[model samples]
Target: MPGWDDNSLGYHSDNGKFFCHLNMTGIAFESNNLIKKGAALYPCVGFSMLQKSGIGGSAEINFGHRMLKYESITNFDI
Candidate 1:
């Protein structure tokens, strides 16, 4: 889990929940999931493989360098 430690946070797609430091925030928000703060932050992604042998998952990430299928948010400063 990405938010299992201090200074880390994660939003889950399965339950639409946010987690931080081994606890769920219990508040859900609908947005592009952006954070703007003065502190230094890094981008992260995580995956889990519970099955021993099966078809795994995949991800395609676009770090604001290409076109997206939907409208983009314009005020991100990080």
Candidate 2:
């Protein structure tokens, strides 16, 4: 989620890849201690750009969904 390479001149010659992601989550009937049951809706988006030697650069975007567990209301990744 962080970058160390300098691209101030708009030139990125890295041989690896650059990645990013965004997520939004909604929950209802959830308590502060996460001891109550709740319904949740989450939408996640991700993007990546790859630059390889003599291969140029490519970019991609992806979307996915996550369901909330009734047994575990404290988990955000699920």
Clashing residue pairs in all predictions, respectively, total: 0, 0
**Residue-level lDDT tens digits of model 1 in 10-62:** 55577776554321342333222454333434567777776868656788888
Report the number of the highest-TM-score candidate.
Answer: 1
Clashing pairs in 1: none
Give stretches of model 2 more than 4 Å off: 1-38, 53-78
lDDT (10s digit) by residue, model 2, range 16-65: 76432222443333222334433542333222445554444344434335
TM-score against truth, every candidate: 0.48, 0.18
TM-score of candidate 2 to 2 decimals: 0.18
Poorest 10 consecutive residues of model 1 by lDDT? 22-31
- The parts of candidate 1 lying over 4 Å away from their true place are 16-41, 53-55, 72-78
Residue 47, model 1: lDDT of 76
